[model samples]
Target: MNVAASIADFETLPRLQRARGAGRIAVGQIAGRTRLRTLFQEGCAKIRLPRPTGPAVEAVLINTSGGLTGGDVVEWQAEAQAGSRLSITTQACERIYRSSGGAAELTTRLRVAASAHIDWLPQETILFGQSRLERSLDIELEGDATLTALEAVLIGREAMGEAARDACLSDNWRIRRDGRLIHAEATRLTGADIERDASSLLAGCNAFATLVSIAPDAEARLEKLRPFLATLPHAGASAMGERLVLRFLAPTGIALRRSLQPAIAALSGAGSVPRLWTI
Candidate 1:
């Protein structure tokens, strides 16, 4: 069957998408407004950002594909205007299903205007056996804009006694401010080879998370947050210029999330947390 038909059939097949296989793409966006306070848009659907106090505007996208085909693509984007605050989070862990012979790709883009703030917080991505998934994220910021974002991945479901015995995963991230590149990172992992290089790749941990923040005085803030990071069990941080990067290697997703909260609080200064995270 064709891809679209396959997806429809899989959705109706009940156990197929969840048990054996499937591919899906979801997109969402939230913006700050004068009268409404905030606004949200998803794929063609729109909703007014609910009022009351909350962390910046936030959105989440999930891919339910049991695996990817030769031409599968997923895309997401977000933008925050001057003086506006927004935070985005994923509803659940992303699942990259087993692949037969093709590869899957996910691309994300974000833009933050001057004096605006944003938190791009997404849940972990879980890769099943024989899964081949490539993911990329790009962030563009106006001078003086601030951003804090996190990306986490788990190689196989350790809780389910699964290990990345035969999986290919590639991830890339880039951040730019005022058209100047500030940070770039990339990683690729596959099969037992990745596990053999565990010491250098992920310190032998099945779960890992990276948090990055960009601001005018990000270096100073990173230093201030360093002391707080030392309080976490398995977290470390580094800073360069207006960019700060933090990494956590843990045995489970809950541990990784716990390590991330305080770090984000220290860097963002907004006591508010993303609501999607609580769910």
Candidate 2:
């Protein structure tokens, strides 16, 4: 009986502000050099490609919205066609601010065609007190394609005197080759006791990093990577078949990066660290 009036009222109702964005990129080999095939970006998600590095392509991801909070969502996708090589890194660390309610969300999807390679090397994600974040990373590989990924997290900034005692985080990663899942892991952190628990995975560490690589030479690189990891206060490396995994934990962000940078450079396709890391 009052359908029109109700519809108008609903349409005029105030809505809570939220940040939303999505970005995608595809690369293909052309005359032995990787080149951009397609690129798309919207809202706060943006992708920038600096000058090419030899035959491989390097891309930098940027979040123009600055930081994320409750009700915010962002997504990114990258593809490497057959015989191509692509490396991606973020312009700076991602910051998660205090959330009033709900949770900030992030998703990333990667595809590697036959004989292709993709390196995902985003910077650290910093979590502030009372922040909430959920992140997922899914990857698909075909034939002998390869992938190298790195994820680093800072619970709080020691230099700034910040603490993440009340922060919440949930992260999941899945990797599939030939349509079969080869790697899967989930991590969750909640409550103020996380930092103080002696048996906790973090063990009082405020910063942590993880690196996973899948390639024909992945296992071979394990030995070389071990030395770099050994120098860290808390670090480990392991290899199985074509996959290599490494983890590092430290009391401060500065301490974590001291050894983490060299380890990444050793495994990087270019055998050098990303430029943004130095900046």
Question: Considering every candidate listed, which one attains the maximal TM-score?
Answer: 2
Q: 1-279, model 2: which lDDT tens digit per residue?
A: 799999999999998788999999999999878899989999999999999766679999999999899999999999999999899999999999999998999999999999998889999999999999999999999999988899999987787898778889899999999999999988788855844356447888888888998977877799877766666668988899988999888888888888688877878776777889999
Q: What C-alpha lDDT values do all the predictions have?
A: 0.68, 0.89
lDDT, candidate 1, at 203:
61
Model 1, 226: alpha-carbon shift in Å?
2.5
For every model shown, the clashing-pair count is 10, 0
Q: How far is candidate 1 from the true structure (C-alpha RMSD, Å)?
A: 6.7
Residue 68 of model 2: what lDDT? 97
lDDT of 1 by residue, 166-197 (tens): 77778999998899888999877767664634
Per-candidate TM-scores read 0.77, 0.93
Task: Evaluate model 2: give its lDDT.
Answer: 0.89
Best by lDDT: 2
